[model samples]
Target: MTLTLYSNYVNSAGERVRIALALKGIDYEYVSVGEISWEVYERINPQRLMPALKIGDQIVPQATAILEYLEETYPKPALLPADPVLRAQARAFAQHVVSEMHAIDVIRVRRFLHNQLGVDQEGIDHWQNHWFANGFAALEELLARRQTAWTFCFGETPGWADLHLTPQVTKGIARFNVDMAPYPLISGIHKACVTLPAFIAATPAEQPDYPGRVIEPKLR
Candidate 1:
């Protein structure tokens, strides 16, 4: 089956799906939709979003939906946990990161903040920093709540939560000037994730249309 993903660098939602695709060892056609206008992207995804996955003749839009589709289709080496409760927990964590934390931390949103709301660059930076720190704080507490020690969120192995996390955290530190000091658990998991080949391959820097500086956060 030909899995064609329409994506771009700096699209956190797209990056989330990329991590899942890599984790499942799925080889896909990377079609660069970067630098496309909203009108153009709307042809692939009506929502005007990046990372629309085409499965055969059917098109799958939205990161969360695409992920669930992939998880169902690619069952082996599961991205979600086996146990039902753990699976729900993982979904909750991943969804929260994608929908809540990551939703506002996008380029368009920043553009909205600046162009529409009359916020300055410093204000935009402050806006991003505030929300990212809030998201990281919640994730830190969640990671600390469940386990004594885990290399990834929800477990030792990289799974659902890690998929959303690695992208968001990496982008956060790189672009938003997010501090990792308050999120030791999250920071540690990110460090461990970047070491893995799949996670590394799925990063924004590894994308074809990457034009920004790459982030390799200090694990110290």
Candidate 2:
């Protein structure tokens, strides 16, 4: 199978899939779509989203779905817990990260606020920070409730939860200067995750299209 990942460097969703591929030890081609036109990318992905995985001839869009496909296809180092209840718990965390946290505060939404709604940078910053804080606060509480925890959120080894988390937390800190001192558990997990080989490889600085400061997600 020819696995090609089409995404920009700064995209969190793309970064998650990249991290997952590295964890699974799957060698695939990385195509930086930072400069492509929407018309061109739409041909590959109908939704015109980033991190679409092309396996042979089929194109799989959406980071969550791509992660699921990878987990089912490459089941050795499981990205989810083996226990049914624990698996549901892990999925719940991922769902929050992807849907509640990301869907609301992604670059596209920010762009719409700026371009269409005439929201200034200060307003956008306040908007983004507000939503991020809400999400992180909930996650911190969840982590605090854990009786037994490992380096990652779900276990000692990195899982899908960690993949979703590392990018969001790291990006929030790196770009927006998010104050992590409040959430010790979330902050610690982000710090630990970056040290791993997979996350190190998937970071924005390591990507081919990383051009210093990346404001937009470049979901071309």
Candidate 3:
């Protein structure tokens, strides 16, 4: 199967899909949308979003959707649990990061706040930090409650939730200047995830179009 991935290195959503593909031991042609024109990207995705997966003749847009397609297509080394309740728990954890936290911090939203809404840099930073803290706090509580023996979010092996959490934590530390000290569980989980080969390989800095750029924390 010829799998082509259109993605931006800095995007958490794209990172999620990339980690999934890596864990599945799948290889594909990676195209960096950051290097392409908007017009070209719009042709690939009407929304012009990063991380669209092209499988054969079919195009899968949206990171969550792409992940689902990958899980369905590659059943071995499953990213989701077989049990229904555990699966729902894992999906809830993934959604907390992807839908709740990541959605608010996307580049488009930050640009809109700065350019269109005329929000100052401080205001934008506050916006990002607030949402990140709220999400991480909830996740910390969730993991604490579950009390799983495994180091990952759900079990011993990393899965859907770990993939989502790792990138968001990476963005939090690398971009938003969010203080991770308060969320020990999240910090610990993130530390554990990064040690894995899949997470390390899927990091933004490891991407081809990373631009050798770095963002120092403004508040933390």
Candidate 4:
């Protein structure tokens, strides 16, 4: 049976898995869910999150889990390195973005939509900069230290770690304005990833309902 990925158009979480699918060159059915009513998604993911993939009859939720599953099941173009230490490092980098830096995008998006919620803009900006600076500082150090063969994040070919890193970097560029100049390796990897057909296929602007056109200034 063809794999079915359940996701909403232009969602960050969904974008994560989409990158993985593209790198693997795996053709799976994309089930696009919308914001209208999530009755179907709610049944699969109680949190009502996008990017819940249905592999055969199994229902998988959370972007991280889905990514790991895909890596394990389809190991042809391996996402993680063969070395255990490097593999752990890859996962660590992936987690650094997912766990530490993810909130910048979330809070920024919230501020953009519901400015009337009384969320202090100054405080939000301060918090966003703090997390982004701290997280990227460490990421820059890590990537610079890695002695690798490929231009991508881990070893060489795009893997689980790169899948997580690039999309978050894309979002950071689009939403947070995180400076990539300080992190040349990260930016280089991201630039390389975007040129690939998979990353191009997963771009937010290519989505079916991408705000009619590109939304500017991220939080305006």
On TM-score, the candidate that comes out on top is 2
Per-residue lDDT over 104-179 for candidate 4, one digit per residue giving the tens place of the 0 to 100 score: 5574565663475665767676777778888888988898888864688886677777778887788777777877
Model 1 lowest lDDT segment of ten: 211-220
User: In candidate 2, what are the lDDT values of residues 34-142, reduced to their tens digit?
Assistant: 5776678888899898989999999999998899999999997999988787788889888888988899888789889988898888898899899889999988888
Q: Name the better of 3 and 4 by TM-score.
A: 3
Local accuracy of candidate 1 as per-residue lDDT tens digits, 38-63: 66778877876777999998798898
The C-alpha local distance difference test score for the whole of candidate 4 amounts to 0.78
Instruction: Tell me the TM-score of each prediction against the true structure.
Output: 0.91, 0.94, 0.94, 0.86
Model 1 spans > 4 angstroms off: 35-39, 212-220
Work out candidate 1's RMSD over C-alphas. Answer: 4.4
Per lDDT, the best of the predicted structures is: 2
Best-to-worst ranking by lDDT: 2, 3, 1, 4
Candidate that beats the other on lDDT, 2 or 4, i.e. the better one: 2
- Model 3 pairs in collision: none
**Candidate 1: clashing pairs of residues:** none
- Model 4, C-alpha of 98: deviation from truth (Å): 0.9
The order by descending TM-score is 2, 3, 1, 4
